[model samples]
Target: NAMEGRVEIFMRNEWGTICDTLWDSKDGNVVCRSLGYEGFTGVPRYNSFYGKGSGRIWLQNSSCNVDETSIQNCIKSGIWVHQCNHSNEAGVKCVPIRLVNGSSIDEGRVEVYQYNQWSTICGQNCSDSEAQVLCHSLGFGRAMNINATAFFGEGNGDILIQNVNCKGTESSLLDCGKDDVTVQNCSHHYDVGVKCSSVRLVNDTHEWEGLVEMYDGGAWKGLCAQNWNTAEARVACRSLGFDGSTAVTQPFKMNQRIKAKFPTYFDCRGHERNLFECSHHRIPVKTGWYSNDECTQAEVRCIPVRLSGGYSNKEGRVEVFMNNVWGTICDAGWDSVDTRIVCNTLFGYSYGGTKVSAGHFAQGVGDILLANVSCTGSESNVLECKHSLMTDHCTHSKDVAVKCYQNIRLNDGKLEVYVKNEWGTVCTYGWDDADAKVACRSLGLPRYYDLKDNKKLP
Candidate 1:
């Protein structure tokens, strides 16, 4: 919260404000940096932008260099106090998001700060990836839960954002929908309340495996291996932003003398998003020592899922993260419907996706996690698609790839459909205005379109 406000300093045991007389954005950058934030668009607010400050005018005539480490180091006149006329005071807008009215900073109704005011993102139509972006912006690892029905109560002012679609890799909420900004006059009933958690693997050289140290009650605590199992591991890895078909959770002996413990007496069904929501009592303050016999820590490793060997990020070999660790999937049943789910889940939402040839983009070095993935054109994620228990029945020669028709690349085409790894031009024999409208809607194009019946193309 200190990131955005009128500039103030502790002088002679009292809080005081800086004069806007010589303050500029360079000074705002120094202020932001001094508060331990990367230099973002630090816009300096002049003449009581955040309302007049009642504190004494402490410093005046400051000409700060953008490269300066702090405002104190900038070229400024002495902090020899000034008259308080309430005319001009320096302020800034930096912190983009916050979690309000929750038991912890990681859980609450989401609030956003933009253009010098705090507001809420209204809409229950949010995805898990979008929620994860929100959590990541707040320095939390990922979203564990989203309370869509105004769970944390109402927020102040008008709804700030609506219909936002984050690609899940952004650093802040302010960076969303740069190409397509979303706005609406949504009601407070659909306020987004979210819960987030952070996880870190400890004492291991591998990137994905270590003794699990879940942040809880304001500190990182070892997960008691009392009932730690595959279910809990699934939640932990998802909290770490990894979505694979499976994860490995086992008891790891990291006998510590005085580390706090998060005991899991077996509640997670492995289908939940995060570990904390699996049900448990509040983790008390730092307490007794934990030995391997009394409290063994949990060690978890998740096979990360990602797209690799792509050109321009739109199409790629759908590689499983564990290069050679996991086996390949049988591409015998992979379909465009399944690819649509993959694109919608991994990439941003798209009108439709085509299942390109196995070797279309680039052959995957890692095995594809999908095993005969089949969807009925209604699944939200590929994980929910039907899959066989069999893997390693395929090869890199059959390593599947995809091309999501993201947005309206073309308003009018021959309307070719991808089936059985081959593109075929659709017959326009019975095509009509209704069919044309459906095509336009799928591509998210304008409603106005011309339909040419019985028209032939070369």
Candidate 2:
């Protein structure tokens, strides 16, 4: 019953509809404001945009000044003064939409408001031209891509708009051509999505370090540094394809005249993938934190690290990615301390693990970048340890490998292994009861099975 369409009014214990002969924004504003909206800035429609209503045509030739509180108080001819039909039913748009559940503000599934509820748009027959118009309306430069299969994520609630067609230059999506109000034949799986290039880090030469700039409403704005912390920096760094944030710097002085367009305080746990994923507090202009001397632009630095050539994210042939090249580390003096640093860098936590040599996991083919490596167990990254830049003594056969304990799991009482991010049963070949006992002890569980029973466990 909340779907878009014809305007209807209830009076004298009977339902009646309004005629479109004299309907406009003034009358529509009165209807929307009476329904608890702040003001109606949306367009008024004729020819039953929401579908024709079946009832008495009560109001006709109605006119309302913009200051009217309700449609009943508006200047109108006597009730049912002229002949009319359901084809002349009136409709109004009271609310608009914005994107959500995306990795950035510029990407996500499309959602619109109707009947006091948020709804998704079906991607069926949605085109790139329409997406371009939508991006422009949201203060974006243009749409880079349009995903029609709910690529970001499936949405909930009603499917509002469908069969949208645009010429790629419209100011708003409401001005686009669409199918008449009818039951949609699509589901949430076919929800529409758009990716826009609207955010960037500026004022720095490095890709990982810069002042944040974002587009909002209809203008580009900068953020304030009242409560900016490392956790918030981590999200920004991760959004730029870094492992995490190492530091948050406030070097630029605050400009009180420059309005802060984003949340003032961000509460992140250092694991969110995007800035919007964190809880935030909007700072009013009158707040004490908005003072000219207190405001400053925030900048961040991120650690550039990644794991490669291992079956699982936890256990990998140690590789350092820098300057856009993937290179391996020599196994010379590789030990638990060095492996611990790698695990900490990858998983954001330490897991004391075993180190393997002679290409135990697999040989890596690249520059034997580092050799004679030594770590103090307190190093945050492998590169922080003492190591040689290049070595000829070690080959791909001596490439370093790690089997972190965090990558193993027990499923249904069976010792399962995870490699390359996939879970599978561990091979029992050459495995003895001593190995099983150590595994059980690591998990803080009693050893209940012998070596002969290991094969049956899986």
Candidate 3:
């Protein structure tokens, strides 16, 4: 409760809450810092998020720069001020993540400040992806290594983060689907240890992977793909913030715009911490490469999946990640079963997806990675779905797209229910879950329509 509660300030021989007027993150930081906390991660709760408070309202329009010494150092109106009530009292929450009992501050057993107590994370589902989030959140470059075997020893407090699954791009560990804490199955022996790196991923379009460039002599330079291998890639990807990464190394085609290259050849034993840690020396830079030159330099796909060219993140062209790059799926055998897998892979669950017409999300470029795709509606990933022997001349025009978590009867917009040869919406005052279920049955589909609330029109 000390970490988060109604913020009350003592003034003029009485304690009184501050009014939630013009309260911002800077103001929240001043409050948290005043209470003996690093307030960089301060979050303000505007509408009494920690519940209402009693007593006279003190300050209003509290303005503070984040660097202020305390709430008292901030500018405020006269005490016992007016114009606000208890329901609008100011509140704040601060996040402070640190590592304990480590060789250094950047490496050790992970502990997070929460609920007025320091908590340990269970190593149950902890991995490199989750480590990336922890490192990034702590102002480090990326997670270089994670030891689920209690590498830096363990902690004694309650285990708050029992399970974590991250895409390796989240700014905070809390954002990356830290599973519900109602169930706690952890002990000190199962605690996690993490090591962060100063290495950064730059010049990348996607989240997980990008061009292999090294900063030497003060400028970023691309790595020459001459002697690169999977061993080098494994180290490089992890340095760039991938968790336990098994990288897909490829000779990335580069244009003439790339002026400089990493002159040294990296020869990794496949277990080094980073590319620099690997043995390396100067290598001859090959010339005679023009535009569209393959392997002019190297790039790594740190294993990623993304939806592209769609209105929403979930509703998009089904571009599967395969062979170190993102490619499309052919609509040849794409169906409801296949859609379910893709939707579930992108999202946790699908409410019976329906595949749209070909090129509905726009014709995709690059290889048609999958074709004759089929699934039994049970697989967790679309790529795992049974399919033909790869794309047999599948064209871009046949690129597949899906609309997930929608009523199976609707496609893109409202007023769309596939009635008997017509299109219209159900208009009724008492229209609820019952009516929608009945409508689905009439259309010969299952119940639980994956419905969203529709506004009642005038």
Best candidate, TM-score: 2
TM-score of 3: 0.30
List per-prediction Cα lDDT, in the order shown. 0.62, 0.66, 0.65
lDDT score for candidate 3 against the true structure: 0.65
Of 1 and 2, the candidate ranking higher by TM-score: 2
Backbone clash pairs for candidate 1 read none
Question: How does each model score on TM-score?
Answer: 0.33, 0.40, 0.30
Q: Which prediction has more favorable lDDT, 1 or 3?
A: 3
**Candidate 3 RMSD to the real structure:** 26.4
Worst 10 residues of 2 by lDDT: 245-254
Better of 2 and 3 by TM-score: 2
**Candidate order (TM-score):** 2, 1, 3
Task: Quote the RMSD, in angstroms, for model 2.
Answer: 16.9
Per-residue lDDT of 415-454 in model 2, one digit per residue for the tens?
A: 8766787777877898876787777655434445654545
Our tally of clashes for model 2 stands at 7
Tens-digit per-residue lDDT, 241-265, candidate 3: 4432324444344432454654556
Clashes per model (N, Cα, C within 3 A): 0, 7, 1
